[model samples]
Structures are given as structure tokens and as C-alpha cells.
Target chain A: MRRPPRALVLLAALAASFFAVPLAALAWRAPWASLPEVLTTEVVGSALRISLVSSLAASALSAFLGLPLAWVLARVPFPGRSVLRALVTLPLVLPPVVGGVALLLALGRLGLVGRALESFFGVTLFGTLPGVIVAETFVAMPFLVLTVEGALKGLDPRYEDAAATLGASRGLVFWKITLPLAAPSVAAGAVLAWARALGEFGATITFAGNLPGETQTMPIAVYTALLRDVDAAIVLSLVLVAVSLLVLVTLRERWAPQA
Target chain B: MAPARRSLGRDAAALLGLAVALSACGGEGGGGGGQSEASRVTVFAASSLTQAFEAMAEELEEDSPGTSIRFNFGSSSDLATQLEQGARADVYASADEANMIRVMDADLVEGEPSVFVKNKLEIIVSAGNPEGIRSLEDLENSELVLSLCNEECPAGKYAAEALDKAGVNVEPDSLETEVKAVVTRLQVGEADAGIVYASDVASAEGEVEGVPIPAADNVIATYPIAQLTDAESAAGEFVDFALSKRGRAILEEHGFLVP
Candidate 1:
């Protein structure tokens, strides 16, 4: 086979290098002197704690909701299903800010469900932890749904039929048969959803608002730092990067089977 | 997942690139402004002033033909950092003076940034006070979720400063990026209360209720504007209009204080 031209190779290299440049730059500018203290600040700590907890909750919730939706979208082909699929994936196209606004419209105190939630249960989502989780889940669920749906369609159905014939309930067959086979994709989806939730900003801010010890996550902390305190912001960003890398690497390991 | 699988080679490369890009992109706006003057003057300012500034830009084009203005509207801290890293803003109008001061300390500004306008902090709640969050002290209740701008954002800083003065610290649920977002959450009831600019609350009108915080009197953040050291001839005119009679009127109409 003919080799790619030198100029083409250079162009591709240039395009690819935009990724590495920013990371190298961050490490280069890392304020090593203040990192330890910055990382431990009460505000940073609280935000990080919220970030970790909310991201995990959202990721788990998304998987719980997304997998079933994925299965239906993939296996139960029906009229307008493509449109339905698009609607489910809408958040991917929607600006996180817009998704946040939509969430507020649906869940805010004056919102339809928001009004019901307050009158019935005295619960208001705005500026609350539940609001944070709701916003994160709204944005991240699509990642899981699309990922799991793809795996479902690519799955071998005969095994599920074999289990059904052996007296397995459809639910049990789904739980025991389809899920195991799709474990890696599901895991990958969960990881993506988790990561998205962990780093989420616009939707969370619009839907949940930042409050320390409540909904302020690391990304929000970092953003605040960049304006209020650059050194602190840099340290928080580094922390976020380190944690994200660790999780992404672990997920990437699980993703190797597909590779 | 199937699409990812099909595009594995390209997508894997892109994904890793994107992660790196995210890490790198976070800090780049501070390092690259060596371009000569007279090409065009790029001014990054807070979003709330988009209408007035764009109107000013249009007027400037008519008044001073050769000179041109490009405005990037967002939060002040974002713009400041962008200035630090060499984003090449010839002028900046921050909703809070502190952000303006931050950029000045970096020696990027041309002169003392004049206090062009003033923004007051107000308690923004959903219309009808559905939760009856009567005042600022109510935010401290664990049941309330609040959103504020990250510390870097002008509005967030002002609120924090005001809260500090009042000796009230409520754990907010999210720290957003801008004032508009904080108000949006309030309107949606994602946050029962957000400390936002009086202008934001004023703009929202009927969608949300604005309760003036008495303690907020201590948190009047002066908005500052100045031509950067890097300004073209156009900078002088822009600054004049911002601080001039017509400019003051436009900002006043938007509910900003005439400095």
C-alpha cells in the first residue's frame, strides 16, 4: 500500500496535537507550591465531596433508567421509534444550559412537577442536592442509553431465547443472560455517564445552583477559583483531572474486551 | 456503542485528544496576545450588558468608521483570565470591580478602570415565593438548595462578599458560571434563592420574585470599565460611551447604578 503523503501526515499531526498541547500546558503551569493546601480548602473539599457523590448517584441512576430504555429502543422496533430515540438523546444535542432551563421548567418550584412536589411534599429542587443529581442525570443518561442500546442491538438474541425456553422469565433472562453479555458496554456507558456527571457545570448550575456542602461540585469550585482565586482554581482543576484520569483509566481497562 | 465500535480507531484517538484538550483548554486564554493594534479591538465583557454594548458597538461603527469593535460577552473573571493569557481584549466591563482589579494587577489595563456602573446583590426567588423563603437567613436551612456563581464569576464574588459582611454562610447546591444562570435557577425554582445582580432580577420581572436584601447594601459591587493597554484607537470611543451620558442611560435602564 502507498504511504500517506508527508504533508497529509503533518496536517493530521497538527490537528491531533491540539489535544496534547492543553494538557502539557496545564501540567507545566501547575502551581506545585500551593497544591496541597488548595486541595484541602473547606470549599474545595465540600465541592469535591458533592461532585463524587452526585456523579456516582447520577451514573447509577442513569444506568438503571437508560439500560431498559436502550433495550426497548434497540430491540422493540416500532413506528416513530427513531424519533423517540432522538428525543431520548436530545440532551446530547441540547446545550447543558438549555437542558438546565428545561429541567427547571419541568422540575422547578413553579414548574409542573415542581408545583406538585412542593404542595404535596414540601420539597423544592432549586438549589438542592436532589436538583444537582436530577440535572446531572438529565445530561448524562443519554450516554448510557446510546451505549447500552448499541450493545443490545449487537447482542445475540438466541441465547436469550434458549434461556426463555428453559423456563426463565423475560425479566430473569434479561437480568441473567442479556446483561452479562453486555456488561462491558454497560460498564463503558456507566463510566461515560459518571465522568460527564462529575465534570458537569452548566446544567448543574442552572438546575441546582452551587451551595457548599450541598451541590457545588469540583468543576464549579474550579470555575469559581479561576475568578476568585487562580491558584486555588488550578489546584482544584488538577485534582479533578487526577480523579477523572483514574476513573477513565479503570473504565478503559474494562473497555478492552470490545477493543 | 456500535457507532463507537465502528469508528473505534478515529474515536479513541479523538476521545483521548478531547480529554487532553479539556485539560489544556482550561488555562490557555492567558498566554497568547502579541498581535499588533489596529486590526480590530476585541472586548470581552459580562453577558448582562450584551444589549447595551452591542448597541454601543453599532453606534461606534457609525461614529468612527475605521475603528471596529468585537465584544465577547460572558462573566468578567472568564474575560480577565482570557486577558491574562493574552486573549487580546482592548477593553473590559466587569460587573464587579474586583475582577477588573484582578486584570489591572496583571498590568494589562491602560489606566485606572473607571467605575462605570454599580450592581446590587438581591435575593432572587421563584415568583409567588412558593417556598416562602422570606429572607437571606432562610438560605441557611438545610432544606434549601442555593446556586451562586463560582468565586471567579463577578456576581458570585459580590454575593460571597455580602454574605461575609452579614456573617451568613449558607451551603449552596451549585456554583454557576454567570448571573443570568443564577437567576434562571431562581425562576425555575431549581434554587429557592440565588443572590444575583439587581439587574438580573429586574430583567426577569414576573418570572421570579426579587427580595432586596438589606444586608446586600454592603455588597454593592462597582462595575469598572477601561481600555486595555493593547487597545486600538477604537478603545477610547468605546470607553467614553460606556461612561458617557447615553451609556449611563442605557445601563441605568437595565437597572445598573450610575457610578
Candidate 2:
């Protein structure tokens, strides 16, 4: 048995304290007695529904797009591909508000595509449910792309080539061969995306505009309630934490990469 | 070696017990004494009162010995919630009477609320007024992408009332969470027009142009202030100074009506 390095020990101690203090504070102040009544409120319920529905939608959308994008980035060799990768991951670094603003500018009714959609097709982005979906997907999809890309790199290309030799088409090989091999990784990506979307605040508030039954997800509800009702904010927080934990636990069962 | 291991385990348990005790007491030996000793006044005020309220807080600090001023500026509703959650504050100044009434109903304030000032709604546009949104009627044009505060927020409610008075059937492109957001969207050309306070438009000199929405029948949100029962002496004095002539002068400078 050897002693841990001093710096690593210090880092571990600091990290442990950092996470423990907040959990302790939350437990200390939580009005556990009133939780049942608080959770049943229309505001909390509506916000929770929106949060769950949109986060799930956002995670699904991310998987649909990000996995393919990750595969391309990992396997394909193209001009300025690194730059493309950077651009795809830009939302990961950009402030969620900035991302929301960018989404508004690009997809807003008067946005580039927005203008095109409105001029010919009469589609609107502002104040619509689609706006919430767009904002969440924009922010969370980066996690999926990065995670899946890592999984793609770790996979054996020889397996896919061997499948091609057996006469499977590219799409068939990807769906039947590559996907199953990366199923855990893809699921991990989706879980990350879901968590990001669940906690998303700035982007949804900026882009979706907090309408009670419309765009007010759990985080938004927590913020709105922070002024009007302290108990509501606490309740919303517990809902958010509980939901995130449950999802993580379920994903741990299905998505955890086993040795 | 066995004794040493037992001693380490005992020490760990003792440290954990002390941690719990420290949290329960809410005060510690000499560690948090410095924070709780000097009576501090915390004022939660509306963002519109930033310039005026800050000046008042400064004056209070200069007037009272060993007194410090803490200012939290945001939407009135947010401040109200902070108080409800046992936040130590001396005074609360809301942007509107409605939010103040809500806080009063929650029994967060000490005495009867006073109408400190009044704020009138003003139409804001991009610096050039490109849309030519002269009066409320012009807002009804479907082509105009107008932004306003949501109905729940003071400014948004006022904007809605103003529009209703003029018999305008304008559909806003988006309802922002705050007045500044509406102003920002208009300034950025994302919205052709918005309705906010004249003082807010004044602050956006290079970015936006302000137009007085006819005050004859328009909504005028009355601002209210009250000291909280939990406030220490220093904070209470600070509240008194804000209601003094100097505070009125600051409000007047910011285009607020003397009550």
C-alpha cells in the first residue's frame, strides 16, 4: 500500500467537500413535510412535464443527428473536417444564452432559414413549442456528438470492413454492425444530452420565452418561482434533482460500459 | 498499528459530528463572527431603480457608523422570493405595487408599504425607429416583429393595458421575461418595437429610441418600498434615507414620478 500523491489527495478532499456542502445545505433547508403538496401544484407539474417531454425529445433528436455526425467526424476524412468538428462542438463552449440568441437569429421567423420558412411556408419559431425543442437540442446535442465520437474511435473498424466483405450495404452495416457495437456509448451520449437539456436555463429562457404551460420547463419554473415562492423553487429543484438521478440510475443499468 | 487505525476512525467520526453541529448552530466560534457582528443593510430593489437606489445606499453608509449597504437589483418578484426564504434584508423596493402587495401578503415586510414613485410606459424602437411605430395602432401590423414583456411581469402587464386602451390587436413576436430583454431585442433589430419605461430607453442611448406612449389613459405602475421586520437597525436606517429627499432626487433624475 502506497500513500496517494499530496496534490491528488488535496484535490480529492476539495472535490468531496465541494459536492458534500451543497447536498448538506439542500437537505438542511428542504421542507420535506410539504413536498407532496408542493409537487402537486399546477405550475410545478406543468414545468415538470415540459422539462421531461422536451428533454427526452432533445436527447432523441441529438441521437438521430449527433451519432451520424460523430461517425462522420470519426471515420470520414474531409477538407476542414477538424474545423467542422470544432463548429459542431461550439455550443458546448458558447454560453447557452448566446446559443439561444444564435438559434433565434438563424431559425427565428425572420432568421435566414426562418425568413425562408415564413416567406414560402408560413412557419414561425418564436413562442412555439418547436422553439423549446430547437434551443434544448442545440445545447445538448454537443454532448452526444463528443461522447459518440469517442466511442466511434474506440471501436474496431475491422469488424465493419469484415461486414462489408459479406455484402452488407453501408447503411445496413452501420445499423446492424456499428450501432450495436456502440449501443452503450450511444445510450451514454443520450443520457448526457438529457441531463444537459433538463438543467438548461439560459437558452430556454432566452429562446422559448417562459410561458407557463408552454416553455416553462422545471429550471425556468424554479427561476420564476424563486421570486414568487421560495417553497416552489425548492420543490422544483428537488424534482429536477430526483428526475436527473432516476434517469442516471436507469442509464447506469443500460448504458454503463462494462469491462 | 491497530490503535492508530482506531484513533483515525474516531477522529473522522468526530470531524463529521462537528460539521453537523456547525451547520445546525448557524454560527461558529470566531469563524463567522466577522460576518454577523457589524449590522449590515441589504436592499433588494428593482433594476429600474439601479442608479437612484445605489445613490441612496451610498448616502446611508456615509450617514451611519459601521453600517454597510448591500444592493440586489433585479425584477421585483425575484427579490420577494429571496426574502420569503429567510434572506436577511433590510428593505425591498419593487418596480410595481402588485408584486409588493404579493410580498406583503406573504408577511415578509414590517410595516405598511409606501408608494415611493411611479413609472410610465414608453415605446422603444431601434435607434432609427425604422418601423415608424409612432403610436399603439401601428403595432397591429402583422409584418412588424414587436416584443413585449409577458403579461405577468409589471412592464408586460402595463404594455398590454396600453395596447388594450388604444383598441390595438397587436400580436407580439415574442414576450420576453424582463423589460431589458424586450429593449435588447428591439435594439438588436430582432424586434421592430417594444414597450418599456422611459428611463430604460434613456439608458439605451445609442441602441434605442424612446417614444412616450400617450399617458392620458396609459398604465402607470406605482413603485413601493417597505422595511422588513428581520432587518437590523442599520438596514432600517438605510430604508429611511431612501425615502428621504436625496432618494426622491435620484428617482426624479431617472424619470420616476414623485409620489
Candidate 3:
């Protein structure tokens, strides 16, 4: 194997230490003796449960909605397509807290559409599970969309054309050929989206409001704990770190693009 | 060869860890203005003190030319933790004594924190009081969406205590981490009612209306300010200035009661 350049290696080593030291410190001071007791509390349990449900729901919704949006952005050349794509990925750059405020403006009780929903059906999305899901989806969907779009763009279109010539319906070609070919990217995107949703804080709290066993996901729970008990916050954070590491390891092993 | 590969793997892990760490720091605002020239003072304060502190900063600068003041504002609990984490700030002002005591216990401050102001809670509703919420009991109606600060927040703790005293068990749709967030919820009309400081209601102007909490049931929120041991003499001066009559006038103008 060729030796890597020395300057690059030194710079990379400095960056590595910068990142590794803090995490090492966290692990070192994690209150190891009380970890089990702290993690077993009702608050932690509820927050963990809610985090799983909301993030999973966000991932599923992103796969369902973002996939089609990505396909359109990649395969179809239409007027203002670039604009549409920018809008789709806007949330990726927008502050999640600002996204939450936007969500409230669009979906809250006094929101433009929300007022109608309230008067007509008495359905309010604020401070509910659906609201959390919506907030997470809004913030996380952009990850899936951008990922899948990149994948779709990179796919060999000759295969898709070959299927089309075989008298397969457009929908059939999509379901049978396009989706399977894009499966790895879709899985990768979903996992990335799920991770983002799981760690989501600003938008979720801003739009859905934090209510324990209602809308208080893990991040909110950890934040609340941080305010009162640093030990509890540390334990909660350790659990999150563990979960994220597991997911990243799994993704790297199973779905990472081979060199 | 195996050792080299292990080190490479560790480097990759550290890089990934650092990426996560950097992302978190990016989310939160940092302390200090990064000024090299001129005497500088940095104050970490509760979010409720935003307006008053901004005004005080101007006043401080006017009194002593070339003395620049910077501020970091958030929930007091978060500020205390930042101090504990060794964030570089000259003075610490908290909305509650508990958080201030946490920093004091850590020996972050030079002397006892002086009570600068007292605040009380009020129920905020959107303009017109659309829900016809007239009193604390009216907030308990399951049909109305309510927001309150998180239990870890001074305002949240006080709100919970007052509610308990009133024998009202309201299921708030959201427990915002900051008292300001509760005010935002009410301002945007996302929540039918929210509990926040009277100062918040005053600052929000006509966007929200305040329903006075019965004085007997309402909890008084005391704000404490202290100079850090590591801060410059200017930090001590600023703290004294904040506790001075002129500073009290600025805070009172924003609806905080002088202690």
C-alpha cells in the first residue's frame, strides 16, 4: 500500500484528538456505578419508548414521501425543477427551531390551515404524537430526499430503459426495477433520517411541545434532566450515544458503499 | 500490519465522534465576543433577562467607554451547567437561586449571589382571549391547549407548584425548556394558554394578553447575579451596576420587580 502524505496524516491526527478527547471524557465520568439505576427510571423508559416510535414513524414517512420526491427530482426534468429541489432540501439547512415555528404557523390552532381543521373537525395537531411525528418528518425528510436523489442520479438508466421496452408499466418498472436498485441508498437514507429524527430537539419542542409520555422524546427528556440532574442527563446521553453508535456500526457494516 | 489497521480504525472512529461533537457545539450559542482589544465582560443570564440585559449592556458601555459587554442567554439551568463545564464568562445571572447555587457550590463565583429582581407568573392567552380563559381553573379544561416551562426551568417549577397549590392538575400540551418558549407558544396562538413571567407578557405586547395569577397561589421567582472569581474587575463592576438603582430601573421597566 502506498504511504499517505505526512502533513495530511498530522492534520487528521489533530482533528481526531479534538473529537476523541471529549467523548473519552464523557465515558470516563459517566457515573458507571449508577448507570443501571438511572437508565431504569420511568422518565428514561418513557422517553426511550417515545423516541423509538417517533423516529421510526419519521423514517417510514420519509421513505414513503421522500422517495417519490427524490425520483421526480432525479428523473424528471421539469420547469423550476431546481427550485423544487432546493425547497425540498431547505429544511436540511434551516434551523430546526425555525422549522418548528414555521410548522406552528402552518399547523397550529390559529394557523392558516389549522384554523380550518379546528373548526371543521376539531382536530388540533399541537402538543400531540402526530405533531411530534410531523415535526420530525419535516426536519428529517430532507436527509432521505437528498440521499435517494443522489442514488437515483447515479443509477444506470439503461437498465430502467430495458425494463420499459419489455412492456412493463411505469409503476411496475418503478416497483420492480427502480426501487430494488435503489434499495441500499433507501436503507442508508432511512437510517440517516432516523438518526436525525432521534436527535431532533429544537423543532420537536417548538412545534409539538414537550409533554412526557406525549411529546417529550429522548432529547427533550435529556434536556429536562440536564436542567435538574446532571447525572441523569449524563446517563440519558450515554444511552443515546450507545444507540447512535450501534446504528452507525450497523449501517457501515451492512449498507456502506464498498470501496 | 494489524496494529496499523487498528489505529486506522480508531482514527476513523475519532473523526466520526468529532463530527458529532462539533455538530452539537454549532447548535448552541457560545459565550464571549472574542474581542482582543478593550476591557471585555461576559455575562451568562436567563432568557427572561434578554431585554433588560441588552439595555443594561448599553448602559454599562456608556458609563465606562471602551468597556464591551457580551451576553449568553438561555434557561438558567443550562447557564449553570455551562459554567460548571468551564465556559468562559465573567458574570453569572440566573432566574432562580437553585441554579445559581449549583454554580456557587462548584466554586465558580467569588461571593454570594445578590438577589437583583423578583418575578411572578401569569397566564398568557392569545389576543381576544379566544378560549375565554378567565382564571387558573379555566386552564384545566382538557379542550384547551396549554403550555408551560419544563419542570427543570424556574418558571416551570413555580408553575407546577402553584398548580399543585390550586388543586389543578392541568395536562400541558408542552413543557417548554425556557419560559420564553411558553410565551412564544401563546404569542403564536399555538397554545390556548401558557404560564410565563409577567415580564414576558409585557415584552410580547399585544400578541398575547396576561391573566393575573392569584397572589396567594403564585410563586415569586427571584433572580440572582454574581461575579465569577476568574472574571476581570470590570465583571464585578457590571454586577454592581446591574444591582444598582439604575439597573433596577431598567429591569423594572421590563416588568421585573426590584428586590
Task: Report per-prediction Cα RMSD to one decimal.
Answer: 22.5, 20.3, 22.7
* Candidate 3 RMSD computed on C-alpha atoms after optimal superposition onto the true structure: 22.7
Q: In model 1, which regions exceed 4 Å deviation?
A: A1-16, A254-258, B1-259
In candidate 1, position B137 carries an lDDT of: 74
* lDDT-sorted candidate list, best first: 3, 2, 1
Q: Write the per-residue lDDT of candidate 1 for residues A1-259, one digit (tens) a residue.
A: 8998999999999988887787776878788988787776666766766777678778878978998899899888799999999898899989997887777777876676877888799887765567888999999999999998998889888999999999999899987788777777777787889889998998886666544445568887675554333456667887888888986786576454543
A57-157 per-residue lDDT for model 3 (tens digits): 78878888999999999999999999998899899899998887787777776677877878899877765667888999999999999999999999999
Of candidates 3 and 1, the better by TM-score: 3
lDDT of 2 by residue, B122-155 (tens): 8888887877778888888999888999987889
Across A1-259, the per-residue lDDT of candidate 2 in tens digits comes to 8987999999999999998888676767788899888887766766676677678778878888998999999989999999999999899999998887677667765466877878798776554456788899999999999999998899988989999999999999997778777777777787789889889987776666555555677888786655434555677787788888887886575456545
Model 3, residue pairs in steric clash = none
TM-score of each candidate? 0.52, 0.52, 0.53
> Quick one: best lDDT, which candidate?
3
What is the Å distance of residue A237 in model 3 from its true position? 1.0
For model 3, residues B46-145, the per-residue Cα lDDT tens digits are 8788778879998889989868786655567756654564445788999988898999998988878899999998899998888888788998899999
Off by over 4 Å in 2: A1-13, B1-259
- In CAPRI terms, model 1 is classed as incorrect
Candidate 2 chain B, poorest ten consecutive residues by summed lDDT: B24-33
